[model samples]
Target chain A: MAQIIQIDRPVETSKSKNVIRKTMSICPECMKILPADVFERDGKVFMSKVCPTHGEVEELYFGSYEMYTKFSTYWTDGKGALSPNVPIDKCACPTNCGLCSNHLSHTGLGNMIITNRCDLTCWYCFFYVKKGLEGAYVYEPTMEQMTAMIRTLRAQRPVPGNSMQITGGEPTLREDLVDIVKMIKREGINHVQLNTNGINIALNTDLALKLREAGVSNLYLSFDGVTPKTNPKNHWEAPYTIENCRKAHLGVVLVPTVIKSINDHELGDILRFAQTNIDTVRAISYQPVSLTGRMSKKEREKYRITIPDCIERIEEQTNGEVTKDDWFPVPTCSPVTHFIEAFTKKPQYELSIHFACGAGTYVFEDADTKKLVPITKFVDIRGLLEFLEEKTEELESGANRYVIAARFLSKINGFVNKEKQPKGLSLAKLLTSALLKHDYSSVGQFHLNSMFLGMMHFQDKYNQDEERLQRCDIHYVTPDMRIIPFCSFNVIPEWYRDRIQQKYGMPIEEWEKKTGEKLEQRLYRGTLRRNIAKHEMNQMACATQAAHIEPITGT
Target chain B: MKYVYEPVKGLERTCIRNISISSSSDTVRLDEPVDFTVKLSVAGGIRDAFTSDLWEKAWDAWDKTFRMTYNIGIKKVVAGPITKDVIKSQKFVRRATFYWSRSPELNPDYSKKIWVMVVLEGREPVHPKSVDEAKTTLFDVKKTFRVMGSDLGKGKHALKAFGKASWGRHIFGEKGNSQSVSKEITITCK
Candidate 1:
């Protein structure tokens, strides 16, 4: 329960599950709280929960028990928010959503839905606005309301949130998007990333430059695959968006919503595509599709891919260039927070999310081999982590700060083999400032030259684990001034997202009448995709010189 | 002809490598200053014999070490307006050396039992993902040395009295991992 996340259920047969920890989960059908068991079978980890009505349900919690245990080694808790909106002591997790005291991590990134409107409607996305649906209301917050939400984020205790992700059906759909970016920056939010389908940016080439000038850090552009078959949603226009962003000097993070038997096969291709455009592309955050709504067990199995499953395919597809051994879970970063907190004597930003939530590693382009070398290969990350932990302990035990600094300078090189690290990396130089000076400029510098591959499988109804909920670092800020974790905010939208948005939103007709504009006016015509087709580079992959693959997998 | 090492009685736990106390000179004059030296050597120190790589034992092994720490010291006196003698070693060590001078106030009979001891402390690290760095002794060791004075006896007797104790010898502490090893050295106070 203390970062171990004892997923419990009544053990059945001795051979079935080697039960490890016991925790609580919710029934997929009725949302009834039930006992769950987390166990290991054949090197894979699984969670089985029992509901009186739904009987016993089993699901794969993690694909690799080896990886699970490895990631759990760095399970360090975070300092909970000093000010809780709901300050109840005894814990009841997802039910207690709005900044509850039981919440483990402070907000790492606050997502604000600038508008629910988008240029294209993809079937997989559930958070966007659908025209024909009942209660199809537009939930675009006014500038004032957004300011208030940013205030809520900045108001977080210990370490106030400094980063914001403006997401929506497509944040670019809002005409005031540039102003919104400016407002977010003005509100003391240092980092602003606009989450969009990139259709608007592709159509309006100058928009990227404008947004960059407005202080937006980058575009969290949705580009699922290298081929149109795997990524039809803006596959045609995405290239133009990246080109424009490059010209504007704005960085981009390619986001692929990977679905098994669908886009999963194209993960390595997506990575290669990112590498091909490594100059402009910052990172690729591959999210395994979280299947929501009612679906048969057979159907769910087709699309379900755990973090390990994705990593396995990545290794196979990359021909073992990137392996499973390279990945470390989200909470593995907690030691840096502990070290920085100890070194700087201040509450620093920590990604103390649940170990099962996400896993990632940095990949550097080796100058000699020209192949992607995972940070783990060149750096002794585990040894460095243990050393940091020991140093933190020494500092806490009244060791002189200068002496610790001197010891840090003397011993840091022992862990990092200079010959193995990528040429021109200056790894120690970049790390020293980030840790010693507490300056994150070095981290940003490292990001510019490297590609960070991350996997964040957001929870849905079928695989909802409350333990993941308690440690959720990615959060959403409501106009009501409550900061809610991402899982509870989107997974159970009826309780949080819908409830809050509906209260603040207006019906489509009413909104149109007030704005003196038709709702369909915001819908972007496929002009960019059609125009890109007529160009000579139409046959090639977006942002690359390689040829594009035709649609084979069904849309 | 053969040296056999029996680990912590029945358990195959890590104990001591070969550690002993030695004086600068076996025989020394009363007015001459003397120094003490502690020599230690071991195979694998206190470490996690259990594989830390195994998921089953990883969590417990993170901070846990089957390994122990040792405090090696030569009990001595600090000369001052109010002179005081140390009863216990203040710090831990594997091999240590100290320089001592005759105190101005203390009479020639100032010496009692000039000895060195090893005080072991703490346990070792992870079940299997990690293991201890291989060394001779996991814990710091203690040893006591004897220099025969004019009142009692004299001359180069600095021989390890512990029978058949040499390289490949193992020492186990029955109490708190603390052991007292005494070495007798020949010194003259003529």
Candidate 2:
């Protein structure tokens, strides 16, 4: 608590073609840190930096300046980590990124890479190992190492990291994956999720049930799109994977790596698919592709898509059912955390990251019309958030706790329009329970009725803003017992991910000989890519069964 | 990123022909919405770096050779000696990035209710260049803002209004603010 930093937020005006603020950015070609200007032109935000060696470079920082300024209003500086891994005197971000003292946010969700081995090889993926490459090694940590990493995450002060995402090239490829989940649960990770392409989960019917029984909460399934072209990774098997998770009573979050000229067009259909299987599908985490390495300016323009771009496209594709105004930045939840902390008189879990990094909203099915009802369409979300902020300020200013609680109870229902709210949905009551009881079951009840749509755009070298980097909340835990931000972990793999993993990792031959299992055997021959994909209800899940879903490509 | 704006003088070819300023109300009270319109008539145009043809070649040639602002309009190549101090200078810094000479009005504060700035100017629809002695164009910009409680006191106030053409923000370590045309009106604030 003593180490928590208070972020100074000054009012700024970023109208047309104005230097919104000055920040630090690295040159793409030279990687030299230089001062950069984040400004707006033609209603778009772009970052410009002048590298001493690389000269000058400008990249689109965000798509819409209007959305940027609106989101920036909720920009809340996070409570930085109390015990930093790498203690530094000065803030040298994107380097010294082992949750340094200057880092602004604690671990909201810590990822542990179980293995760098996958079933399928995607050209755009940088997580897996390449055979015959120099210093190529199978980066699978021992059970003891994983236990130590989970313990490190649990040791975080203020709010100990409880959510763990076990990610990898393919986590299910490891034979001891269920045991790993058991170990993470044994170490007090309440929510354990497996990040996988889901070929194994779809093929092995018992695996989903086994993992669920072993304390795995959900499957962070890699589901790009519903069609073959957009989701070549798991289009044929994702339906089976969803069915297995349904049977096992496990939740699944569909992840789509959206690219501008690529699979971005299917965003609407993907949301519909989630709604169709809303019983099992909890959320759709749309991740815009982070283009690493250097490339020509023309190439970047072809595939570059920012967060607002995705939300705008979703609005257009969904026929205006879910417009851009419905979505709020991820840090909008900070007010809830603040109010709860002030009420409980202790630090609570908070998602206080840069507002530009992500945005989200929840949608519930209408009882009568069966139409998707976005939370914003019914409730005054901005008004409620602003009210919560006001109440939190009052509580912080020495207002009576019980009086504030009574005032909060009296005022909560004013923000929700009862006529527009979905039937059987009482958001005011749900919020009341969440604030009073503060338990997982209240949130679980909320998740049972609606679907969360999230947009998280990871940064690359060209568009990296160090201000956002210093406040990143999604982190990765390494075997060295240090937590790393996701951008520094994979975006600059040569520095952190690869360097540390290779140190604690072993060669492919050595790993194979020790385990007596060939690395090639880990590859799934698409056994789940059998017939019945066309007959699957996933096509019906996107709710495009009548007009859009074609018989041939499962559109 | 540098927080500076520079003004280029001797653009005698471009000067404000006429200027006027007006407010929506003769008396402004706190939290009252008032529309302010500033109009200026001027000939010629401001220099824009992006529309210039040298923008592409300036990156490769910036370090080896420098180009001065006066010789920038035309494609004629004028060379200057490369000095270490020149690289760190604000002029060189302005040349690389987009530091334009826009006819932007002054912005005092944003906590006011609303501010709508409208500018009327002309250029080629595609790749417009600053004309040295082009047609005289009329610029009318309006901003609707509310008087803040913290800004005004209960008294007779003289509101100084000026329709001037200057660099926006004027942060380039310049000596004094460049002024073109102006007027003042009296208003009572309560």
Scored by DockQ, the top model is 1
What DockQ does predicted model 2 obtain? Answer: 0.02
Where model 2 places Cα greater than 4 Å from the true spot, the runs are A1-17, A531-555, B1-190
Give the C-alpha miss distance for residue A222 in model 1, angstroms: 0.8
Model 1 chain B: weakest 10-residue lDDT segment is: B95-104
TM-score to native of every candidate shown: 0.74, 0.73
- Write one digit per residue (lDDT tens) for candidate 1, span B15-76: 44555656666556655655555654333322333222221121211211122334444433
Candidate 1 C-alpha error for residue A532, in Å: 3.4
Full-model lDDT for every candidate: 0.68, 0.69
lDDT of 1 by residue, A137-156 (tens): 88999999999999999989
Residue A28 of candidate 2: its Cα lDDT?
74
Of candidate 1 chain A, the 10-residue stretch with the lowest lDDT total is A546-555
